[model samples]
Target: MQLEITGHHLEVTESMSNYIREKAERLKRHFDQVMKIHFILEVEKQRHKAEATFHVNGNHLFADAYADDMYAAIDALTDKLDRQIVKHKEKVKDHHRQEAAQLVAATETTD
Candidate 1:
């Protein structure tokens, strides 16, 4: 998976970049098919915002968070993305199970 981090209206320091990368790597544990992840960090007045777009296989998942601290915002964003990835995995599993059941039923009917 590719990770791209960009900052808007703020300079992305080395420590911050490393922190983001480390947090993002955790996602791979849940879903290995992640193709690309793009993160955008922005600071507007007192709000520090973090947003990420994830490309997993053929699906796109996105989440954003706002907090008073940049690290907190990134944490929130990752948590949201993790939940979305788990949900997506469940949906895909359920879809394949449903399809297999339907196929078995059709074959039994023909037999």
Candidate 2:
């Protein structure tokens, strides 16, 4: 997957980029259909904010976080995205199974 990181008011450092790379790899492990990810970091006074938009298969997932430190915000953002990715995976995998089962049951009852 492709990753793009942009800063709003601060310059992104090598260390921060590496940290985000590691987190993104972890996310890729959870779902392989991830196509692209765009991350935006912003600093306002004392708040550090991190937001990400994930393009997966044909759908998009988004999550944002705020913390006292940029690293902490990134961590929280990853956690939230992880949950959303897992939920999406489940929905994609199970979307048809339930309907197929219901159809089978209805046919059996009619016979």
Local distance difference test scores for all models: 0.95, 0.97
> Which candidate comes out best when scored by TM-score?
2
Clashing residue pairs in candidate 1 (N, C-alpha, C atoms within 3 angstroms): none
- Please list the residue runs of candidate 1 whose C-alpha ends up more than 4 Å from where it truly belongs after superposition: 94-111
lDDT of 2 by residue, 11-95 (tens): 9999999999999999999899999999999999999999999999989999999999999999999999999999999888966
In model 2, which range of ten residues has the least summed lDDT?
89-98
Residue 79, model 2, lDDT = 99
TM-scores for every candidate against the unseen true structure = 0.85, 0.86
**Whose lDDT is greatest here?**
2
Q: What would the per-residue lDDT of candidate 1 be over residues 1-111, giving only the tens digit for each residue?
A: 899999999999999999998998898899999999999999999999999999999799999999999999999999999999999998877677889999999999999
Quick one: how many clashes does candidate 1 have?
0
